[model samples]
Target: MSKDSSQSFLLSDSAMQAASYSTYQNFQSSPTLCASELQNWKQRIGLFQTHLQTTATPTQGSLFDTTSTQTSLDSIKPFELRRQNTEFWRWQFDDVGVPAMYFVIDYIATAQKGPILLYIGETVKSNQRWKGVHDCKRYLTNYQQAHRDTGLKSELAIAFWPQAPADRPARQKLESQLIYKWRSPFNKENWRYWNTPFITGKEP
Candidate 1:
């Protein structure tokens, strides 16, 4: 394997170790929720579980075309972004973060979906974004529980783009474009396409 591949393997292993250790701690304290996690599965799982029940039924709408998502030459694919070095820990780490275009991703790939891009966002305060009130955090809770309930593996991590435009308006415009392009399920704009269960009373 190449140098980059070796580093990636080490990173992936460390993330797994962190998650395993956290999960063990959570299980020791509370069966359903971890200290790092904001909400309990019971609180968020109900809606997602119900939605999963009917996923077999045919749906009419189309998901955003992730295959067509693009980035400037200086940028990489959303899935290509890694934790810390570029991504910094969105879950368990120091809150000091940088201005970046960020992605919330499920690293585990299934034959059906490959790696799941749950949300795409841009933030001047990438690390501090979750430090304040953020709805996306709750959505992520549900999304993870949805996977767990179905025995699906999910390696949820946040990543960043160092090349994001410095201007807030320009950065936000790029964020909007990518969000629409990927139609990431947790993002409100594409929630309808995925039958996102966490949306209030709407089944988006």
Candidate 2:
């Protein structure tokens, strides 16, 4: 037989013998192979070890490596609330050059606790805050009327977080997470207080 074919037959025979001795005790008690076959087996084992070592050592810039993974994570900036205002409408328009998510909060004095999140929303154009005013104005008016009728001391304010301009999906994801975390009453999906005025046709 050719040299390569002879080597393959020797390796296959060694593997079959190893498999036949199923248990660890059986494998240890099995008779040793001839010197030539034993040398071939040792050489194959050394080659496998070298292959395993090469594969286990990560090459630089590998996508699955720790350094590359950490660099990807570091690229993402944390979301932070940049501006807050009680009269968001009165705030002058400035092109922030980023998409933004905003929160409508109510400072309820009667509750004697911190501000309560009323609604969460996002906008692709940060300067075009007016585009969202219709819903904000309506909710605020209804909230004020309802509070007035019940004699609860409350004031509305908006908080904003500007995010990188191209990430509209990220902004929306953040909005959903915040809505779920705060359980905002006016958010339609988290409609805990959907029966509140202006939402349930109880406009004041």
Candidate 3:
């Protein structure tokens, strides 16, 4: 086998072993949530769970793979941006108020920088979020058609807090807070990373 392939095998083996060890340790040290905390988490789940149920009805195929409904690239100018798709990947890491994990699109000059566009949004469901991204991509295309000088690319980064507790309310609140807090070059208000708004759903 080639040297690259051999190295990949070694790395894969190491990752598997590390994961196995981590799982064993977690199984040994599980903690229980207090009653009050659990109740709050349940409430948050109920509100956002509806978004999931509504979107789950099925619309189109995988948004990332198909171009049938995708926006064309020739229209919009590409913007310099970066995306961060982060996931906790561990149930034990989840905390009640804090986001268990997130996929962030940081619009800056970073190693992960990619194309950019206008208006970014976050969703609880992965597929729905991806569809949102597709829409952004299309928007970028249309934008280029409208203003050729803008020269920005619309990009999407999908992250999930799968490790987050299944309690829908807590997860929704966490995600909304994260989005509210998210900071990017394109972020107009600069609300995230500061005392902006909670999940009040009201304009701050």
Candidate 4:
């Protein structure tokens, strides 16, 4: 389940620029004056998706292997992925929850090809996982806000994997598998696959 960077699929100069230093804003205008730079990031991600769809192959790695991820997503019924307004932290049950794996995805991109898996993680306490300060929360907010500001729609939501292993290490291993398989952008392991522009860090 280890997909390393040994594969030799190269992105275009623009995409590379977006993925590396994230120099898009240098030649682009801000979506909002004091807002996080996410609109441009979304545009860059869309370009990456379009290019990868026609060019990606099995040997190239699972970073853009949408077919498998799409199939996996299809297996999960719509009812499985739950949503409870913007402040999703409240979705937890009675302050206690079973250990599980969670997925953050956006459904609005289905018309283009398929839904986007933005992030994945395993938690011993599913309900408490998103209850407090979480970096992914900020990332998701930036993502959804960017869409709203740019006049686009994004059906963002979270879904738990019912078969997640109760063991923490096993859960984490499975979590990593999904993250690499789907190339979820918000996950740090996947930042190399995409620019991760929503987050403020040393990397692009």
lDDT of 2 by residue, 1-204 (tens): 244322221113333334332111111111323444433332343343234333432333432336644343233222223324434333343333246566666544223233455677777654456443255455555555554554455655565554423477655655665554444556777554233333433212
- Stretches of candidate 2 exceeding 4 Å from the true structure: 1-83, 90-97, 192-198, 201-204
Q: Which of 1 and 3 is ahead in TM-score?
A: 1
lDDT by residue (40-128, candidate 4, tens digit) is 45545555544555553233354334675445533534224543232444432344456667777676644555566677878876556
Predictions: Cα RMSD each: 10.5, 34.0, 21.2, 13.7
Q: State how far residue 189 of model 2 sits from its true place (Å).
A: 0.3
Q: Compared with the true structure, what per-residue lDDT tens digits does model 1 show for residues 1-204?
A: 244322322224465455442121111111243422422322233244234334432222343233332315213476666653212333553344455787876665343334556678887755456554456656655555655655656666767665566689778766776666555667888766665555332112
Q: What is the descending TM-score order? A: 4, 1, 2, 3
Q: Write the per-residue lDDT of candidate 3 for residues 14-120, one digit (tens) a residue.
A: 33334432111111111233444423332343333234333422223332233431222111112222222211122222122222333433232122322222233
Better of 2 and 4 by TM-score: 4
Best by lDDT: 4
lDDT of each: 0.51, 0.45, 0.29, 0.54
Can you give the TM-score per candidate against the true fold? 0.58, 0.50, 0.27, 0.59
For every model shown, the clashing-pair count is 2, 0, 19, 0
**lDDT of model 1 at residue 191?**
64
The TM-score, computed over Cα atoms with residue i paired to residue i, of candidate 2 is 0.50
